[model samples]
Target chain A: MPMMLDRRSVLCGGLSALSLAALNAPALAQATRLRMIWWGSQERADRTNKAIAAFKTAKPDITIAGEFAGWSDYWPRLATQVAGRNAPDIIQMDYRYIFEYARRGALAPLDDYLGKGLTIDDFGKPNIESGRIDGKLFGINLGVNSSVVLYDKAAWEKTGVTPPSMGQTWEEFAENTIAFGKKKPKPGYFATADASGLEPSFENYLRQNNKALFSADGQLGYEPADVAAWFKMWQDIRKSGGCVPADVQALDQQNIESNALTTGKAATAFAHSNQFVGYQALNKSKLSLTAYPRVGKSSPSGHYLKPSMLMSVSATSTNPKGAVDFINFLVAKPEGVDLLGVERGVPASTAMRDQLTTKLDDVSKAMVEYIAAITPEVGPLPINPPQGAGELAFVLTRVSQEVAFGRITPEEGGERMVTEAKRTLARK
Target chain B: MALHSEILSKEGRASALRSRGTFRRILERNAAGYIFLLPWLLGFFGLTLGPALASLYLSFTNYDLLQSPDWVGAANYVRILSDDPKFGAAMRVTFTYVVLSVPLKLAFALAVAMAFNRGIKGLTLYRAIFYLPSLLGSSVAIAVLWRQLFASDGLVNMALWQIFGFEGPSWISNPDYALYTLVLLSVWQFGSPMIIFLAGLRQIPTDMYEAAEMDGAGKARQFFKITLPLLTPVIFFNAVIQTIEAFKAFTPAFIISEGTGGPINSTLFYTLYLYQEAFGFFRMGYASALAWILVIIISLFTAFSFLGARYWVHYDE
Candidate 1:
């Protein structure tokens, strides 16, 4: 009797569903469907999908499809899709990519669409202007982020060593690292990953010393002596066994998850602050964030607040209006911001920042507070990197490895880097 | 057979003229067979040939993937051949890899095949167990496994320390040893070639071995004078295929190195570097140029093998 009832119920439900679909076919066909893509951890993707679900609930007329990928796979997948001229309606852009894509006319300009197709009235001027290429808006700033030193608080305690203070100098940090390494249980464990060619921290070091990675005209801005000095400092620490041996660290290829720090071979590492949250999630250790180690006798500040990632529309999107509306929902709406909180970084919109700061969790609140405290120390953001700028870090890593291995001296590696930098920049 | 010949004239005089669309006549004569072949032909033309031709065109241009390709003629080829240090390194590494891995893997495969060829119980089960790595190898997961196996604190080091009372260098990371680890990985997946060798071994008539035994030819003597000479054709086939496969090594290096081809570019296989140029650096034009060069190199190697085979490959014919 129960089986008969189940069969009858299934038949009746199927007939009603078919009739409903047949009745609403035209309306479904008329629905404005949009696609969006971004790259991050599963946590970010899940939070983002929830916000998009809210948008769906808020606007029944528009249907949205979403795709997300891990960081390493994202650029290749997106480039392939763009080359096929099938780019999604909305794309998540990095600060480094805005100029390249905008120059290529791949990103849609949002100047005319502001307050019409999209809304950025509440966004701060500095945040709004960052997306501009040649005085035209090409990306919408989603969040402002910066880099920090992520260290395991437990590791520090276990070593009986104090954390590097906020204004710790490079000399002091190296001494601290040596002390930390001495407390480790194993012979091979070190206090940190090798930091000679870690570009973000190296950039901060340069900036603190009144230099930048690239000049306004996209040339190597630092003197070879400056690069040599930076390399020498790390070389000294490496020789003192203050950091993981070069080959061991190179084994992991500087990926945050697999790096010596996360594998319990180090106490401190440099990463973007947004990644701090993700790092903590993977690293079961108690973690804390601090400013980049300062260059001795340099400026008081070296850090810059960077746009974590930005939202942009494809120039060739068929549903431009739908794309803008979705973008508007993501960055400007209360419902969306409520779900998103500060997962991306601190909100770029001033009002949203004020509203969400109090509601964040312990770690997220600490991230926001860390950024705010460092705000006074940070200088203005540097210009977006040039076309061939992406490969510069690789050159730095390759040659620095040579220095660590004693195949070349620091001075020679620095000169090699400068020469390679010039050759690389010339291609742009 | 009747239908196949029916399409041709008795005197075959039609071959002198009206040769255009001749394929259509042959195709129509065996329409059922043609229908059967349509899927493979479609795959060849649409999937393989189309991209291959497109890459040829791209090789002559400067394409950044973000913008339309700009024609640059021989500029890409000139740059890769002359200016790029990593290109030379990758070529050196790939050639070294192929030269070392091909001979080692084939030798191991043949040795194992001979071992299993003796009358052994559960022969089928032994063959299956040995072939498992060939089935599962070359996948990204297996590459990841190889990385863990060779890690500083991984099983390899543990074994070395416990059993040999020796410390192992980081196999996958140390610049001096990274390429050799990948070669060992290639050698480990010798099951496919071993199976082929086993088949070739089985095909040698038992009576020949009996005759050699009666003549008092020892095991090693028989192996050199009988087994190897007759198995040259299979050896040639396996060597050619393995060399080409080694030249295209990417996944193991990519997974093991985290796609950066690092430790001072020690494990930067040719395909990995090409992938980095095209996808990582957006230098599709240069990458396409590299791809074409790889094709030519492989083709030359295959041609060289076929040419060299005549003297050594003693076919029964």
Candidate 2:
């Protein structure tokens, strides 16, 4: 009797298992799940989620799991994920890191999927080529951005000082800043945040002098004397009270919210054009954008329309086709483009740009206009920075601070900076 | 009778078989206990020992996380000791923090513990309230709060301006004062050591104090001569543990400086530097070397502490 019952139960179990598999087959076959990760603010995360929801509604068969982190935490997390061979299907990459990741084979080359699944034919040659490393496409340009001087128009007007113009020299800008500082709009407020430590601002200064932060061969493009001269200019400005004090400048944690301009310690800040909206939101006064100061009257603008960030598929992704389709949706499709807006910077595609122009808010409109105003003066994009370029940037900030605090002279700071930069680049 | 005799014969045969092999006898004796210890054994080997051994191997190689490691011998260690300036900066910062913060924290903890031992009203409530900071001190939120409090326009500065008409610099952002603010933070979270001190205070007999008082000893005399000597072991314990913790401090400095270990690397703790190398710069091999160096330093400190304790730590022998 026991044997008979056992056999009966086994048969029943087999039949139930068959039915369960039959029920799950359609769901399993249709769901091509993908994971995408990016780093940005809460506002960016919300916009990204809305775009993801829209994509889900359009493609009911594919599901995407989105993850986001702040910029400081993003790279470490991504590096760990890639090292563990469990990288997300889609990654939001930075210009400084794209070369490293692509060269190391952590990212998939998107050239094969270009016409078939990834439609970026309208993204212009330079914009598309910005993502290439060693002649192979590795990332897709999500938007275009350039560094700018963002200042409070009201603050400058109150001081009766002329605001910085589009093509002003660094000397003229420094004079105006000192003039504003003399007015003393607030007890502790300075005209500008100290930009000596800022990497982008330094890079722009280098380019105006016809030197770059790095050569095409991944070596220092400028000498220690160039760095010392740059540091001396800022030091003179700092001495004349044209910029915030060293301690006050240190409070800015390289974010829009913590910036000296936003915190009311200074009237102006050095930032990328994409950050104008965030800075405006944080400040009580109206903020405006102008080009970074040039070296002289006939110097290059030292600005280029580079990708603010890019979307790439990981090399180890199981569903590269699906990831490409989603990326195409983000960069090319109207619905995705409309939702993202200019948060990541101006959209790369002309069609998407035209569509969003009518709907953009005033702050985003200012960013677009600023980019347009400087388009004719902008220079060609420099090569992607070398692998240890990130550490070199921090080295600059450290040495800059030492100079700012009067702990070391600009010449010593410059020498130290070069030694450290060379040592960092020489490692592996 | 026949069944009992058969059972006895079986037991005698099993004992004879067990006595034939020491390994089998040992396993047989503690099989159930070993089964119960399996989870902890697995964790120690898989989680702790395994990774520790791997890091040891990686320390001698040039591992950049993306590529496979190449053997580099003791080059990383040599660079750290001789060539790296940041390593020196980090060591100075960490040692200053440990030396300044540990004794201050322990003194604060002992003072509070003694106050509680006097059987004050709401002793438990005060203990809980004071202990709260330790629970939250190492957390990221508290570190961020510390940043806000020490900011140029933050509450502390606001209070100073309102009361003293003084404009203070940003404490956490100035190289001259950044490490000291961290020391203050370390001193503020003295709750765990306070609780341990309280337990030790309770263990001391009241008769000694009573006898001292009967002998016309004043309160200060009683404290120095009786209470302190008796509490030496507890003080010694707290000192060693707190010193080790201070040496390993990372979060407050990381959050306060926003991970640059600036202004001018004044707040660069050794572990923070290690993290920057491993995660920020992806120099895993060099970071592993840093980790091993830290282990050696900490071990040496601990060994010296134990050896030195014989002179100060009084026991009831």
Candidate 3:
């Protein structure tokens, strides 16, 4: 019986070895593969594939698969993939969602990799700290973006209003917009793009008022009156004929490519510094960036340095180290910066930024120089707002629409916004 | 030896009888068929049943997807029903949408179906064309197209200006008109109900029409007395289903309003609001409660339909 058992064992082992050899045939035939996912336009996609071809030349052992989408569709797709635990090893993460993903054990902490000298720090303290959450770093800033005013240079020049200087007050800006709007023909043009909704408009207002969206403990940073007053500013702007109706502005957000500003209907549009790449990719017109007008000459109140976007490794990833290496490459490698261009933002790392800046076209270079020239009255880096932040944005938009349409008095809208905002905060 | 053989035969017969009895018992036990349903039973237990039960349990707790669910008894339900103004507003919006849109859609569908029932030329092509909107209406492309048509500078405004010398407000962006646009969309896709009515109209016996004509009934009289009475069952079915669908409408409002339910959340339907609570706010407990409330509302409406059927629905049986 013992002799028979030995013979059977040896025969089974030989057969299993043959089966294993068959499985390895496909792996031997194929190149080593990695997947990367990002959000961008066609131009960025073309550039990315070009960079992938470059990477393949350097490391013949590796090949990459790419997935891309527009800005509106990107985050939701990434979030769904993360939830399903089938995330791409490389992810394009945004700052607002970074803390939430990291805190929930969805992101791999990158401290060990950073300690191995894989981080870029000379960009500024604020730029690097925005990537850190709860003493653990989950993602690296892909680029640096501050909100800026994007104006059609030709349109402004045509209207005979010189572009406002960086230090102009909000009052001065509004007055100039009103004067400029009067020269445009019906249905083809307006002055400033409509304020997106109350919260974004209020974010600027709060900056002017020296307030933030939340306190250190994540509470409402201002009273309902603050909401109403801010919403009223939009009303005032629209009423003063310096802005388009709420409907037209609302459409701008739905399709930035089709936005009135891009179509030359409006002279000015509000955008993150990163958005110039998308506009330039689609439109023929030359565009330029300026700061949010300084309220006073001494008002240290311009846009803050924000995490343009970040790349985080999923906690459930099988290859955490590989994910970290890839993220480090995305932020710190010249090739990665060249591939991404200004789609993410201007590169946060000084070395990578300098390497990519020469390759950028005229519009992108304008954005980079605009950020460099700002006098840096930047606000505190944005934290992930409370859990109900999306709801907060929706409610703010609703009330702002009411104010814009004259359906609700600004005071009434404010009271309503406070009630809803508090309710959202309580749930959080 | 012969006696021994006979005894063995008798023992074999007794054993066979016992086996037969067991088979009979299985045949008599109704649940024996459940073994054949094992695959569905497993899926229901693993997927649908588990989540349905879990959602009910979660309705009493505070749950965000990232964190472990925390028990809070009836706190979420209480807050949603009493303290939350959005909840009340959402309910009103949903109710108004269902009540206003369902009957109008059904009536239009029946009218179209009647027109199509005549021996019209190119009947199949016309039917396909009429039904195409229903098939495509829920698609993201159609929703985007709707946004473009109703936007301030959209095709509709262009037409209004070209024809009437006046520019129209943005139908999708204006709060007063956003809900109406959704209703118009619902009405536009009335093909499913129209098809059902066409099928019902075919089921009515031609002899009844002949008999009604012999009894001196006019076309209108024949429709009221015979065709309408016979079509009640189909009408009732479509009504119940369409009402439930209207109550849960989301996409047009979501896409057209850009998920804000603007211009002042006047187009904020209940399910959209519920989704906002669940996914956007991460208030899973509250969303669960809201979902259960929807289930109750739908069930009550369904039950009311069944109760009302005795008076209006005429089954061929």
- DockQ (CA atoms), all models: 0.62, 0.71, 0.40
Which candidate model has the greater lDDT, 1 or 2? 2
Give the Cα error of residue B306 in candidate 1, in Å: 1.4
TM for candidate 1 is 0.93
Each prediction's Cα lDDT score?
0.86, 0.91, 0.76
- For every candidate, give the share of true A-B contacts it also has: 0.78, 0.70, 0.42
lDDT of 3: 0.76
Lowest lDDT sum, 10 consecutive residues, model 2 chain A, at A1-10
lDDT digits (tens) for residues B244-280 of candidate 1 = 9999988898888878787788888999999999998
Model 1, runs deviating above 4 Å: A1-25, B1-24
Best by lDDT: 2
Global CA lDDT computed for model 1? 0.86
Clashes of 3: 0
Question: CA shift at A257, candidate 1, in angstroms?
Answer: 1.5
lDDT per residue as tens, model 3, B1-317 = 66545544775456556756666444434343577787899999999989888889999988765566789999987888788888887887788889889999999999999998876999999999999999998777898999888878789999999999888987876777878888888899998999999999988889999998999999999999998998999999999999989988988877776565666668888988887677655567888989898889899999988998998888877
Worst ten in a row by lDDT for model 2 chain B: B3-12
lDDT of 1 by residue, A185-277 (tens): 677788888888688878988998888998887778898888888889999999888888877777755566787778777778888887777
